[model samples]
Target: MKTAISIPDDLFVTAENTAKKLGIPRSQLFAKALEEFIQNHSKEKITEKLNEVYSNDTTKKDNSLSDVSVAILRNSLKNESW
Candidate 1:
């Protein structure tokens, strides 16, 4: 596919230099960059959807242990030399 797009001169120069240094054509460099950008954003979209689904659960649960258990655990930890 052949297409044209405009970018800042500095970016264009940098891409050109990178392509030369990597021994690839400018089109290949642009295509690779676009492909990588799309793949990354696709993963981000999945994460966003997972976050949206999980965000709807507003329920909170008490996960803390009883005071006696906490005191025993703390005493055991204190006896161990760090």
Candidate 2:
């Protein structure tokens, strides 16, 4: 697929330089960048949906662990450095 879009000259020059440095065509660079951008926003959308669902649910109980469980977890992690 072919498309045309306008961007700032400085941005265009930087992208061109980056493409050359990476030994890929300008189209490939733009395509890869756009693909990553779309994927990242897709993840963000999923996170937003999950947050909305959890926020609207009033029946959700506290997720705190029992004292014994917390003690076990803390003991397990004690061997590891922060």
Candidate 3:
């Protein structure tokens, strides 16, 4: 895919140099950066959805159940040779 975009001159030079140093074309560098940007934005969207769901939940946690789980975890860890 071919696309045109504008960026600062210093950044452009830096990207060009970095791409040359890494032996990859400037287009690949931009593509990789754009791909990372999309991935990061997708993660942000997922986090936002999770936060929304948690905020709307009304479940109360049982202290005894949590304590038992923690105790079991501690017991399991104690027997491990580290």
Candidate 4:
């Protein structure tokens, strides 16, 4: 697949240099980077969805530890006389 990408000149220079150092064409370097980026972000999206589901399920029950907020902890500390 042929696509046009508008990359910043500095970044392009660095990428080109890296490709040269690795003895690979600049196109291959870009393809590998795109593949890795897609895989990583896909996993991140799945993890985010799982976290959302876990949070929703826990909300229906008494899960004090997971539900505690930073504000609540700060207020508790402030109210303490010691």
Candidate 5:
């Protein structure tokens, strides 16, 4: 895919220098950087969205745990051979 992006002059200079140091083309460097940036920030964006939704919920809710289920969980925790 071919696309156009405008980066600041200083950042472009740094990117070009880094690309030369890594022995790769500027386009490859930008693509790799974009891939990493998306991978890192997408997870962060998902977490932020989840936090926003959960924090905005004002209702105190009941969890559906039965007494037998709680006892089984406690027994499992007490037993070393889980």
Candidate 6:
């Protein structure tokens, strides 16, 4: 597929330089950049969903759980040098 878009001359030059330096065709550079941009954007969406899932107070840690965890950590680390 072919598509056309416009960008500033300086940015275009930079992209061309980067593609040449990396030994890839301009199309491959653009495609790789777009793929990374899309992946990062999708990660943001996944993080938002996780935040929503953990937003409730019921998802928060309580004192008993913390106490148990601290006791276990202390027991495991007592014989080890700090």
For model 3, what is the alpha-carbon lDDT of residue 75? 92
Cα error, residue 39 of model 6, in Å, equals: 0.3
lDDT of 5 at 56: 78
Q: Please give, for residues 1-82, the per-residue lDDT of candidate 1 as tens digits.
A: 9999999999999999999999999999999999999999999999999999888744432223465678889998997988
1-82, model 3: which lDDT tens digit per residue?
8888999999999999999999999999999998999999999999999999888745445667788899999998997988
TM-score of 5: 0.60
- The residue pairs found clashing in candidate 4 are none
TM-score of 6: 0.69
- Reference-based lDDT, residue 27, model 3: 99
Q: Local error of candidate 2 at 74, Å?
A: 35
Kindly state the number of residue pairs that clash in model 1.
0
lDDT of 4 by residue, 1-82 (tens): 8999898999999999999999999999999999999999999999999999877865545556545665678778996887
Give one clash count per candidate, in the order shown. Answer: 0, 0, 0, 0, 0, 0
Local error of candidate 5 at 22, Å? 0.3
In order, candidate lDDTs are: 0.90, 0.91, 0.92, 0.89, 0.88, 0.91
- Candidate closest to the true structure, highest lDDT: 3
What TM-scores do the predictions have? 0.67, 0.68, 0.68, 0.66, 0.60, 0.69
Error of 3 at 35 (Å): 0.2
- Residue 76's C-alpha lDDT in candidate 4? 82
lDDT of 2: 0.91
| Candidate 2 vs 5: which has more TM-score | 2
Q: Candidate 4 versus the native: TM-score?
A: 0.66
Which ten residues in a row are the worst by lDDT in model 4?
58-67
* Residue 9 miss distance in model 2 (angstroms): 0.1
> What TM value does model 2 have?
0.68
- Model 2: weakest 10-residue lDDT segment is 57-66
Please list the residue runs of candidate 1 whose C-alpha ends up more than 4 Å from where it truly belongs after superposition: 58-82
Query: Residue 1 in candidate 2 has what lDDT?
Result: 96
